[model samples]
Target chain A: MALPLNYSFRNALVRWRSTIATVLGIALVVFVFVLLQSLAAGIEKSSSNTGDPRNIMVVRKGSTAESASLISRQTLTEIRYFEEIARNENGEPIISADVLVLASLPRRDNSGEANVLLRGVTARGMELRPQVKLAAGRWFEAGKREIVVSAKLAKRFANFGIGQSFKTGSATFTVVGWLDGGGSAFDSECWLDADECRSTFERDMYSSFLIRPTDEAAGEKLITRIEADRRFKLKAEKEVEYYRKQTMTAAPIKWLGGFLAVMMSVGAVFAAMNTMYAAVGARTREIGTLRVLGFRRRAVVAALLLEGGLLALVGGVLGCAIAFYWNGYTTATMGMETFSEIVFEFRVTPKLVLEGLAFAVIVGLIGTLFPAIRAARLPVISALKSI
Target chain B: MSANIVTIRNLSKIYQQGDINVTALDNISLDIASGEFLALMGPSGSGKSTLLHIIAGIDRPTNGECRVQDIDVAKLNESQLADWRNQNVGFVFQTFNLIPVLTAYENVELPLLLTRMNRAERRKQVEIALEIVGLADRAKHLPKQLSGGQEQRVAIARALVTDPALVVADEPTGNLDSHSAQEVLGVLRTLSRDAGKTVIMVTHDPKAAAFGSRQIHLEKGELSK
Candidate 1:
C-alpha cells in the first residue's frame, strides 16, 4: 500500500532551511532562463509583426536587406507601368521607389553612439504603409529637410524629439513628428522625403521598390515577371515574407539562453540532490519504521520524488512571475539584417511559463531518483539499529 | 493448549563480516504458542535481537525453517514477505522509533494504512489501541512532546493497532526509565494475556523478562541449560 502524501509534505516543512535554499537556487536559474528566452521572443515578435502581405518588395538579387540593395531610377520607371500594378484615385501607379541609409546618433543616456535606420519614401510610400501612424506633430513636407522619427526611437536617441535637429555629413535634419509602428520593425526607423534624402546623401539610385498589386493573382504574376527579366537583376517577394526572414537576429539569443540554462541546471540539480540525500540520512530510522509498517520500496521512492517535484514547482512559479515583470517592457538590440538598433519589448507568453514549470519539474525528478533508491534499498534491520 | 503461532526448527543465521563468517544464531529451535508472552534474554552479542528479527520476517535464517501462522517466512520473496509481515506481525523497537513529524494518533494509524480498512475503521482501531495503552488523551502529541514512557506507550499502541496475531519487540523498554519501562511491559503483557496475541520480546533486564509468561536465555548464539 502507498504511504500518505502528507508524510512527504510534512517532512519537507520540518526541514524548511534546506528546502528554501534549494528552491531559491533553482529559482535563480529558472529566472535567468526565462528572461533570456523572453528577450529573444520579443525580437522575434518585432520582426514577424512587420510588413503587409499584399505589398511586394523588390531588391537587388543578391542583397540581404534593403540597405544593401541599389536599383537605378530607370528600373523603377520600367516596373511602374506594369498592368498588374494597382492605381491610385488620381490614376497614378501605387508604387514607391525608396532609399535606406544609416545615421549614427547619440543615445539619450549618453552610452555612446549607435546606428539608426533612416528611410526616405515618397508620399505614395506613406499611403502604402498605413500601419505607421503619426503619434504627435505633423508629417514632413517634400524638400523641407524635415523628418518624422518613430516614437520608440525618439525616446531612445538624443535630438529625435519633435522640433529637434541632428547633423550628419554636413546636412542638418529637423524632426517634425513622432510616428508609432505598433511594435513592428518600422519602430526602429525614421522617415523623410525621398528626393531630399537622395540629395543629402548624393545617391542617384533607389535602394528598393515597394509595390502594391491589384490582386493576389496579379501579385504572383508581378513576382514572376520580375524574376523572368534577367536585365533587371532584381528579386520580388511579399513584404511580410521578407521581414520574416530577418528574424534570424533572434537565433543567437535563443541558443545562448538554452546554453546558459543547461549550464545552470547542472548546479541546480546537484543542490537538489544534496538536500534530498541529507534528508534520507536524517530519516534512516524513520525509513526503517515505514518498511516495518509494510510500505513497499517503490512507495518510498515515489514519496521522495513527489517531495522534490513539489519543491521545484514552487521555484518554477516564482521564476515565471519574476519574468512576467519584464513583459511589454521596451528594450533595444542590434539587428543583424540592418546593422541598426531595433527597439522591442519583452514578450512573456503563457506557453513559456508552462515550459519553465515543466523544465523545473524534470530537473527535480531526476535529482531525486538516485537518492530515493538509496533510501529504499537501505537494510531495514541495520537502519532500525542506527541512531 | 492453543495452536502454535510461531515454529522454528534448527534455524541458523550467519553474517559475513568482511572475509570471516559470524554466526548470529546457531542451530536454535523453539515454538511459541498462541496468546503466550515469551521473552528472550541475553547479554550484548548474544543474538537475541537477531532471533527476534528472523521471527518477525525482517531477516531470513541461513538454514532451516521459520513458520509464522503456518507460512514459511524464510522461503517467501521480499515482496511476499513484506505483505506477510503487514498482515500477520507488528513490531515495536527499543527507541520507540516514532516518526518525529507524525502525532501519536497518526503514528498509531500507520500500520493500519497498509490494510484495506477505511478511514473510520482505521480510526476506530487506532483509538482502541491508544485506550488500551492508556495514551488516548495524548493522541495529538508529537513524539518530542511526549515523555519517554508516553512515547513507548504510543509505540505499543501502534504495534497493537493492526491487531496482528504476532507482535515482536526488540528491546522495547531499553530506553525507558523504571516507571516507563513498567508501564510499557504491562501493556505488552495485557496484549498477550487479555487480547490473545503471541508476543516475543528480546530484552537483557530480568525485571522486563519477569513480566512475560515464559522466559528463555541465550549466550553466544546458544540457548542456556
Candidate 2:
C-alpha cells in the first residue's frame, strides 16, 4: 500500500531531539568502530611489505628479525654465487645482506620513547625497490654518515626531518634524504649504508639477507641449498606469505578491536529498540484510527520499521562523513612485528565506508523487528480504546 | 420491509478487569436494513459502541454471530476483515481521527489511495467530498488549523471518499460545542436524508439522536427500540 507520506515524514521531524540523539549515538559508535579498525589496519599495512611473490627473505634459523643472529659480509658475497639467485645484466647477483638495528627515540607527542628500525643497504637497494622514491630529498651517500629517513617516519615525527641530527651512543648521524616506498613496511624505517650502520650502531654481523630468486618457481630449492650447507644456518620464506603471516602478528589487537565493536554495538541496538518502542507506544491511538480507517496491520508495522531504517540511514551517512576527515591522518604506533614505532595513517577507503554503512543497516533491522511486531500484534479494538 | 445489511444473533462482549468480568454487551440480536439512518443511544457502559464495533467487523463477539453484508464477521480472519472494511465501511470518531500531519485535502484523499484510482481521479473524488462538507476553501489547512466543526467535516469527507456502503460514526459530536455539534449533525443529516446513505451513529446526546430517522437505544447490553 502507498503509505501516508506526510504522516511518516512529519512524525520524524516533530521528534527532532530524539532523532538527533539517536543519530549522534550511532555516529559515536561508528567513530569508535573506525578508530579501532584503522589501528588494526595500520598494523596490517606496516607488516604487509613482505608480500612479493618472487622475493624471498633469509633470516637466522634461531631468531626473528628483532633478534636475528647476524651473517658475515664475506658470507653475503659467498651466498651471491648460488645458482638459484637471479643476476643483473652486469652479472651481479640480485641479493642483499642488509643490517637491521633498533634504536629508541623520543616521540614528538611526548608519549615517551619508541623503538624504530634502521636498515642499512647497498646501492642495489634502489634497484631492488623500484617502488621506492625520494618524496622530498636525495638518497644516502655510499660510505657517509648521511642517512635517508622513511617517509612514514618523517611525516610522523618532527625529530626525523631532513638535515636533522640524532645520536646513537657516541656518534650522531645526519638525515640527508627522505625516502618513500609507497606505503610498504620499509617506509617505517631509516636507511643507511651497511658499513656506516655497522660503525654507528657499533656492532652488527648482519641482520638478514633479502633475496630475489633466479626463477619465481625455484624459491623452495634455494631454501634447501642454503639449509643443506650448515655454515649459514638460515631459514627462508616467500615474501608474500611472509608479510601475510606478519599481519597475523597482531592477533591480540585485532581481537580487542572486534570485542569492543561487538560490545558497544549491543548497547546501540538497545538504544534503537527503546526509541522505536516508545514511538510505537505513543502512536497506539493513531494506529487504532488507521485500523478503523481500513489500513492493514502489516502496513502499520512497515511504517514503524521504515522510521527506524530511515534514522539509521541518516546516521550512517553522517558517520561516514565524520570518518572521511580521518583519511591520511598520520600517526605512530608501536608495531608488534619488529618491536618498533611504525608510522601509519587512517585508511578510510570507499570500501571501509560502505562496510560501516552496511553495519548500521543491519543494526537498524535488528532494532526495528521487535517493535514492529509489538505494534502489529496490538488489536484494533484495544488500540482504539487506548489513550 | 428491506434487505438487512447487518444481522446479529446472540452477540455478547465481556470486559475483564482484575477479578470482574463486567459484561459490556450481552445476548443481543438485531437486523439493520441498507440505506437506513440508525442512531444508537446509551449511557456510559451501555454497550452501544460495542454493538457498532461488532457490526463494523472491528470487534468479534464473544458468543454469537455477526453477519455484515452477508458475510460472517466472526468467521473472517483479521486480514479479510481489513479488506472488507476497506471495501465496504468507513468510520468517523468523536475526535475526528483526521491524521494531524495531513491537510484537510490529504486526509480526505487517504481512503481513495486504497482503490485503483489514479492521482487525478483521487483528486476529483477528494474535491467532491470537500465540497459536500463545504470545506473546499479549508482543504489546504491542517487539522489543527481547522475548527472542531471543520475538522469533523473533514473527517466526514474522509469517510465518504471511498464510497463505502456503510458509514459508522461513534459519538460523532460528543466532543464539540453545541454550535459545532449542530454543524456536524447537519452534515450527517444531509448524508442520510438527502443522499440516501446508510449511517450508523452511537451517541449519548438525545439532541443528536433526534437527527436520525430511527433511534435504537441500548441499556446494559440489551437492545431497546
Candidate 3:
C-alpha cells in the first residue's frame, strides 16, 4: 500500500532537532554556491559591458590585451587619416592614441601593495568614451604631471583622491579629478595625457588606438584595411568584441568556484546521510509495525525519501534568500587580464538562484538514496524485535 | 460448526544464529475454523509466535506448507505475500503500535489505503471502525493523547477497519492494565462471536486465553494437542 505523504512530514516535524541540523548544513552549501556563481557573473558583466560597438580597437597582431600591444608614433599617424574613420565636429578623425601601464599602489584598508592600471589618453579620449563622466573636480591639463582617477579606484586606493599626489617610479602625478565609468571596465584605470606618460615611462610607442568608424560598412572595411597593410602587422576588432574576449580572464574563477562547491557538497551530503541514518535507526520498530500492517517496503522507502526532499527544499529557498538580499553590494578583486583591481557589484540573478535550488535537490536525492534502500531491506522479524 | 479457514501441514521454521541453527517451530500441524477465537499459549522460546507469523503469511516455513482461505501462504513470493496479508490478515501488537504522529482516525484508515477505495469511502469505513471500538469521538486524538484502554481500542479499530478474513494478535494486552486488557479482550470476543471474523491470539496468560473459544499450547518448538 502507498503510504500517505503527511506521515513523512509529521515524522520530520516530530524530530525537529535532527531535521534542523541537516537543513542548515544544506543551506550553507547552497549559500556558497549562489555567491560563487554571482561572482563569476559579475566579472563577466564587467568586461562585456566595457566598450561601444561603434568603435574599432587596434592592437598589435598576436597581442592578447591592450597592455601588451605597442603602436609607434609613425604607425598611429598613418592610421589616423583613413577614409572609413568617423570625423568629429571639428572635422578631425575621432581617435584616441592611448598608453597603458601598471603601477603598484598601497590600499587604504590594508598596507599590502596591489597593481593599478595607469592609462594615458589623447585629446579626443573623453569624447570617444561617453560612458566615463567627470564626477568631481576637473580634467587634467595637457603636458602636466596630472591624472584623473576613476571614482571606484579613488575609493579603493590611497593618495588617489582629487588633489592628492602619488609617486610612481621617477614621476609624481597629481589626481586632479575622479571620473565614473558606470560599472564598465574603465572604472579600474587612472587616466592622464599620452605624451607625458610616454616621456615619463621612457617609451617611444603607444599601447593601442581606439577609433570610431563612420558606419557598419566602414567598420568592416576598416578592419580589412588595417590587417592588409604590410607596413604594420596589426589586428582590428570591434571594441565590444575585444572586451567580450577579456571574459576569458574569469575562467580560473569559475573553475575555482566549481571546485569549492564540489568539495563542500561532500560534507553536506554526509551530514544529510547521517541524519537519515539516525532516523531510520530510531524508527525501526515503526517500520516493522507498518510492515505487519501490510505496508510494502517500497512505501516505507518512498516515505523516507519524501522527508529528505522536503527538508532540502526548505533549505534551498533559505539559501537563495541569503544570496539575493545582498545583491548590488560592491566589492573589488584583481583582474586576470589587466593585472589590476576591478570593482564590481554582486549580481544574484534569478537564473542563478534557480540553479542553487536545483543543486540542493540533487544533494537531497544523493543523501537519501542509500538510507532509503537500507530501510527497505531491513528484515521484518529483526525490525520488529528492535525496541 | 464453522468451516476450516486455516489449514497447516507439518510447518517448521529454522533460524541460523551464527553457525548454530535454532529451530523456532518443529513439525506443527493445525486447523482453525472460521469465526473461531483460538489462543496459542506458550512460554518464551516455545514457537507459538513463529506459528502465528507463518499463518499470517509473514514468515516462511523451513519445511511443510500453510494455506489460509485456499491461498498457499508458504508458496507466495515476498510482494505477493504482502498483498495477500493486506487483503486477508490484520495484525494487533502488544504495544498497541499506533503511529504516534497519526490521529486515531488516520491510523484506522491506514490499512484501507492499500485498496482502491476513494477518500469518501475510506472516511466512511474509518468512522464505522472507530464507532465499533466506541472511540468515534476520539478519532482526531493522537495515540499519545489517548489513555491505555483508548489506545488498545484504537488498535482494535485499525485491525477491523479492513474487514480481513483473520486477525493475528501477539500479546495484545501484555502492556495494558487489567481493566484495559479486559476491554481489548471484549472487543476481540465481539469480533469473533458477532462479526464471524476468525481470530488467532498468542499470549502466556491463561486468564487472557479464557476469552477465546479454544486454546492450543506449544512447548519446546512442538505443539501439545
Which is the leading candidate under TM-score?
A: 1
Candidate DockQ values, in order, are 0.80, 0.73, 0.71
Maximum-lDDT candidate? 1
Tens digits of per-residue lDDT for model 1 on A1-387?
Answer: 677888888888999999999888888878888888999899999988998899999999999999999999999989999999999999999999999999889999999999999999999898888999999999999877899999999889999989999997458999999999988999999999999888898889999999999999999999999989999999999999998888777999989999998999999999999999999889988898888878889988999999999889888888889989999999899998899999999989887888888888887887888899999999888777777
- DockQ of prediction 3: 0.71
CA displacement after TM-score superposition, residue B137 of candidate 3 (Å): 2.3
Lowest summed lDDT across 10 adjacent residues in model 2 chain A is found at: A62-71
Q: In model 2, which runs have C-alpha deviations exceeding 4 angstroms? A: A46-54, A61-78, A155-158, A202-204, A218-233, A249-253
- List candidate 1 segments past 4 Å from native: none
Q: What would the per-residue lDDT of candidate 2 be over residues B1-225, giving only the tens digit for each residue?
A: 368888889889988799999898889988888778889998888999989998988988889888888899889888888878888887889888877777899889877777889999999999999999999999899899988989999999898888887889999998899999998898888887777678999999999999988899899988866
How much is A151 displaced in model 1, in angstroms? 1.6
* lDDT, model 3, position A117: 84
Q: Is the docking of candidate 1 incorrect, acceptable, medium or high quality?
A: medium
- The CAPRI classification for model 2 reads as medium
- Report the TM-score measured on chain A for model 2: 0.90
Q: Could you tell me how far off, in angstroms, the CA of residue A8 lies in candidate 1 after the best superposition?
A: 1.5
Best by DockQ: 1
Evaluation by TM-score, superior candidate among 1 and 3? 1
For model 3, what is the C-alpha lDDT against the true structure? 0.89
User: Worst ten-residue run, lDDT, model 1 chain A?
Assistant: A378-387
